[model samples]
Target: MIIKTVKSLSQALLLVALTLVLHSCSNPDEGSAIETVVYPSDVIPFMDQWKILLGDGTHTDEVEDYEAPNFFYVANDGEADWVVYKTPNAGVTSRTSSNTRTELGQIEHWTPETGGKLTGTLKVKHVSTSGDARAAASYSVVVGQIHSNEGNENEPLKIFYKKFPGHSKGSVFWNYEINTEGENAKRWDYSTAVWGHDMSVVGSSPKTYPEEPEDGIELGEEFSYEINVYNGIMYLTFMSAEHDTVKFTKNLLQSEFTSKAAIPKQILTLYVSLGRDGIERKNAYAGEIQYFKQGAYNQTNGKDPEDNMVWSTGSAIYDGDIAKQYANGSYTEVWFKEATVGPGTAPN
Candidate 1:
């Protein structure tokens, strides 16, 4: 009886030992557990239709299965997953642009006559706050644009969001880069205000910030824009719950600023530093092939502000270290919850 009892005890002990060993091997260390990264495509299904150029000089035409760490990814914005396009102030620049971008370029290109439509609903999360406050491009990011593919490769539309440090609200504006007929080097952009002061608004000095626009967008506020080019006419609609919905129309086939006399006071003040006083082509963007772009195209850079204060931002980059830039508020991050790209529909 004693031997049988001892044998039973031994079996029970052996079973318990085996169970402990199995559990230890099966359980993963909580500290070392890996997180599943969400790609931009996972959050935004339309990513398959466009290609992307990351801030790190990474380009992928096939973005359906592509993902880049620290540049483009999925982020949770309290309510839902959002597609984030983030870029440092300084990084491996693109071939045609001096600034860094984590933006998408549409695969489809269309002429103004054929027309195209693009829409986006997004929120500006952050912009660099360490640049020259007086510079026009300082503390600004390009959220959407229309880029010409041929000729001088000029940009016809650039939707911008700019905020000075210590301000509660930022300005939203759009710029039109003239397709200069002769020399591309003499081109300049004409800006129009959407929700606040136009890009022409600047500070009195390099360290000074202009008066905050009474009607402007606060950080993380939601806004939507529609770019509809129908029958050579470009129509824009901007909507936000807090502000009045605004609509604008311009003829892309005809030139509005054909002579220096037609230039607005804002343009004169904004372009004075850069000497970009050239006029637009008589037939503005006519017969040009254009494509749409969306994401965080960081306009701020580390360039010396004295060179061209309007374009130079002198933001801190920490030598292209993305982690350091994030820590120092030297990065641009934008989130998009919904967007669509397709052929332009006939206007009602």
Candidate 2:
């Protein structure tokens, strides 16, 4: 009888343990369901081809299975996954730029003749809301670029998206910085509009905001761009499902703004006060080493706009506190669902 009782006791204990395990499995608060976390590399597989610089000045080349909190990371918005690039209006930036960025720089360098291409499907999530409305660079962020890695490290192309506070729609534009013939200090970017007004559109006073673009893109609207430099010529295509598609062709081997007279009217209004009327060299970014960059290059800063109204943005930084700036709308965020880096293909 004692032996039989001990066996029964052991079986009862086993049954009790099984019941507890089943109950825990059904309880979400006490469940052991492992959630699979996603990384930027999982969403976009081109992390190996590029190195990244985060908003707080973190740089890394090995981005495989890597994710940085509140800066470079992956996000899911119910329907799709996105690689998010976020930065405050002010942060520890690289030596070359006063502005901050959480952007990817292409590892492979190429000349215009050698040719390369980059494509990104993204949407601008947020832009700094506190800035002088009259300042041209205020409330703006650069999303893509063809950056010159050599010769003063000037940028050949910078695609921008800007919106004033209280505006429902924003402008999309691209700027070409003159490969200044003599002085890099005199370099200026020539702006061209794709959907709405170019970078030159601004209010008359510091606090006044301009009218919203009628044919503009909203903050979360999707857009895509293709930058193809083939045989010393750069071909650009901007596309969106709700907006008209636009294409532009520019010659990298030749200068379009070689003379002062070639300067566009937008520049006259935007940079004439700063005396940035320098012209490009005859061979514009032809032999210069170049690379592609994509992400949120924050244009807003805490500088006084009265110093350089065209380029400076008087945004609130909360004494360089990134958390405060992010909470107060003094930040920029961009999300990319897709991106590609490869050799330039022949134009169709």
Candidate 3:
């Protein structure tokens, strides 16, 4: 009888130890005394291939085994580990951008002819809960991007995820900004839906929200995407466990929207009010140096909605205080479990 009692006690002790381990992993920022702390490189091992920009405008190229307390770190949500990218709605941003981010920029650049590929498996943990609903950038974040290093420095692609307050599901969409033929003042982006509504679907007023999408992703749901630019053609693949796989293709060496009359009706609706109707260059993004970016690029900001209805979010920011913003739900957080960066692969 005594032997059996000891065996039962041993099993209980093992379970208790596992619980303690999980608690430590889920809350790494609680303290720095954790000996089992894991860095982002420990999970993905691709940190050496990229540099990082934190929400507070901290840049670093030495992420071999690094972790920043509030901006970048590791988290485990019971099942698996993830590299967390978090940023407040308002903070120090790049010179060209108003929003903030804690993101990784690929060190290597490639032309459309040379080509490259980037893949990621991730989930959205949080998005700003307060914003003017009529604004397109409200309650949203950009997860991946293909940024140009030449011309007007316009983005060729941006993958986004957005959710409205009080809604259980959000949308996953992508935008393609036209390579303007002349002055970039008229540049505009055309959005396409991947899992739910596109950027054009917004609330009618500051407080009102559109009807929730029936086919949408929830916060903390896992999804994957593959971007392959091969021989001047860009191929995209998106997959989720509960949703059907989706794919798209675009030519970077050729222009798809070079003519004024060729514009889609959606673009007319989204940008006609802003007077942005520029056409793309004939060669599109050909011969331009481009790089990849991945992480939580916070879209919401404290800019007044009356100024620019599209990009302005008019969300609460706690005066650019990151700690207060995090405590009050004015931030974005993304977690990635898997990712890769290398040369492009021919499609099977």
TM-score versus the correct structure, for each prediction: 0.89, 0.92, 0.90
Question: What are the lDDT figures for the candidates, one per model?
Answer: 0.89, 0.93, 0.94
lDDT of 1 by residue, 1-348 (tens): 999999999999999999987887888573476888777787778887899999988998998856777888888867999888999999888888879999999999999999999999999999998898777899999999999999899998999999999899999999988888878876888899999888878888877899999999999999999999999998999999999999888899999888989887877777755788888889999999999999999999999988886888888889889889989999999999999999888865
TM-score of 2: 0.92
Which residue pairs collide, candidate 2? none
Alpha-carbon runs more than 4 Å astray in model 3? 1-34
For each predicted model, how many residue pairs clash, with residues at least 3 apart or on different chains?
0, 0, 0
TM-score of candidate 1 to 2 decimals: 0.89
lDDT string for model 3 (1-348, tens) is 999999999999999999989998998888676587789999999999999999999999998899998999999989988999999999999978999999999999999899999999999999999999999999999999999998899998999999999999999999999999768988888998999999989999898999999999999999999999999999999999999999999898898898989888987877878888889999999999999999999999999988877899999999888889999999999999999999998987
Q: Put down candidate 2 lDDT per residue, 1-348, tens digits, no spaces.
A: 999999999999999999998888888687556889899999999999999999899999998898999999999888899999999999989889879999999999999999999999999999999999889999999999999988879998999999899999999999998898756887888889999999988998987987889999999999999999999999999999998899999999999888989988888888888988788899999899999999999999999998999878889999999999989999999999999999988999
lDDT of 2 at 209: 84
- Looking at model 1, which ten-residue stretch has the lowest summed lDDT? 28-37
Flag the better candidate by TM-score, 1 or 2. Answer: 2
Model 2 residue runs over 4 Å out of place are 1-31
Query: What are the root-mean-square deviations of the candidates from the true structure over C-alphas?
Result: 4.4, 4.0, 8.6
Question: What shift in Å separates residue 120 of candidate 1 from its native position after superposition?
Answer: 0.7
**C-alpha lDDT (0 to 100) for residue 227 of candidate 1:** 94
Q: Can you give the lDDT of residue 268 in candidate 2?
A: 84
Clashing pairs in 3: none
Error of 1 at 198 (Å): 0.8
